[model samples]
Target: MIFTIAHKEFRSLFSAPSTWLILGVLQFIFAWFFLARLDAYLQVQTQLAMVANAPGATVSVVAPLFGTLALVMMMLIPLFTMRLLAEERRNQTLALLLAAPISSGQIVLGKFLSMVIFNICIIACSTIMLSILGLGTRLDFGLLLTNALGLLLLTACYTVLGLYLSALTKQPIVAAMSAIALSFGMWLIDVGSSDSGSAMRALSPSAHAQSLNSGFIFSTDLLFFALFIGAFLFLTIRRVNNNRLYA
Candidate 1:
């Protein structure tokens, strides 16, 4: 049942021109960034090649590229999230969904997972670009995998937050803006600490991701991500239930 709703939402996203426009812009940003990073990386590689001791691809250059991607995903998700619930409410389709045999949790999960899967596809596409990073360099596969997991965990948190915000508002624009603001606020909170404020970063999903970025995948880090994703999923379900009550 949830899968059905996810399929519908995923298909609907392609039907919307604005979604395609945003996606095109995302592609441009990624391409531009990848080229720039690779240019600098190739230069650094040449310089390091002069020395016998330097590794082919330094973590310094590679980690920042993935880090940049993590931040970009943080910004891009709200664009997809806005229409999830807001469009349904605006078109008066939500009532139909609510009236269906499906639980509010199912509706919420379906929409949320659809966006999550869509995002996964977007990130999956980047593997080709990241593979380019590995072609001539001795990149650590395990480190890359760890970073990918970190990004996935972070995306889960952002998607649920956006889905919940979309469910709260009837206006799609308002939902998009609110979700972006909220996600950006969380990100800025981490930025303000500059990796020095463990208290602040520890609680922030962005911070947990930075931990994985450093290749230290602690049990606490895994627990934090699991809790983060679960907490937002629970909140979104609760929010959807509240909407049903208010209706």
Candidate 2:
């Protein structure tokens, strides 16, 4: 049942012109940044050779690329997620969905899975671009994998938050703005905190992602992402159930 809904949502996304435009623009931006990073690395290649334990191309280029993508995804995902449930409610289709035999969890999970699959495509495209570096230099596969993992988790967090917000309102624009504002607020927590061990900083997904961005994966960071995603998914499911009951 979940897969059925996911397939429907996935097809819906592809059918939309905006999805194509976003993908095109994102690919162009990724390519531009990759080239710029490669150029910067080349300029410093000779200097790097003389230094001991110097960072390689992966550290100098790929890591920063992932970092930049993280921020980009933080902003871009709300646009995709805004219309998930909000548009359905606005169109009076959500009540139809709620009346169906499928459970609320299935509805939420299916939509969530659709977005996850879409994000995987984005990550795959970036990974392919970075894979080209293997031809000219040694790439740290471990670090690359870690960055990919972090980005996936970070974006998943964004998706669920946006999904919940979408469930709360019939206006897609309002949901989008709310998602972006909350995301930025969490980012601000990470940025504004002065102490490394500050509890407030730990609340930010960006803060947890920093460790992964640096190629180190701590269990705590992984747990934080798990809890964050799970919490939002639970909340979204509850919201849908409420609609189902009240409809």
Candidate 3:
């Protein structure tokens, strides 16, 4: 039953013209940035040639590539998330789902799965650009994998949060604005703080994602991502059940 609902929701994502347009633009940006970074690497290769045996030089070049992936996700997720529950409620389809035999948990999970699958496509498309970098120089394969994993977790968290926000509002624009604002606020707080004094930075998803992206797969980061996603999703299910009760 869950799979049936998830399959339906997944297919429905393609019905929007904006989804295709946004995807096209996102792919272009990924390709452009990867090439730009490659060109910069080539330009610096000459200077690097002079610094025979510079310590941790390879790490410096690779770090920014992973960082670029993080930047792309931060921008793309908000746009996708805005449409999740907000669009359904705005058009009154959420009530339809609530009235159906499906439980609130199943409905929320179905929507979340659909969004996660869409995100996988985006990440897969971006990999082509990253692959092109491999031909020019040997890149750290593990770093790339870690970077991708971090992005998936981070995006999942964003989707959950967006879904929760969408359930709280009837207006799609309001949901979008609130979700984006909250995400951006967390991002800035996480980034602007010093790592040494980052006791409070643990509250932000981006900070935790960065730790994982840097190949530091700490348990705290994993637990945080899981808890963050689970908490929001649980709240969404609660909201859906409550709405049905009052309706």
Q: Rate the local accuracy (lDDT) of all candidates.
A: 0.80, 0.94, 0.76
Model 2 per-residue lDDT tens digits across residues 130-247? 9899999889999999999999999999999999999999999999999999999999999899997899999999999999999999999999999999999999999988885775
The TM-score of candidate 3 is: 0.91
lDDT of 1 by residue, 57-118 (tens): 53655567678888998888887888888888889988888889999888888988898888
Best by TM-score: 2
- Best-to-worst order by lDDT is 2, 1, 3
lDDT of 3 by residue, 113-170 (tens): 8888887887666655575557866666677677778888888887788778888877
Distance from true location, Cα of 134 in model 2, Å: 0.6
RMSD (CA, Å), each prediction: 2.0, 0.9, 2.2
Worst ten in a row by lDDT for model 2: 238-247
Candidate no. 2 TM-score? 0.98
With a 3 Å backbone cut-off (N, CA, C), the pairs that clash in candidate 2 are none
TM-score rank order: 2, 1, 3
TM-score per candidate: 0.91, 0.98, 0.91
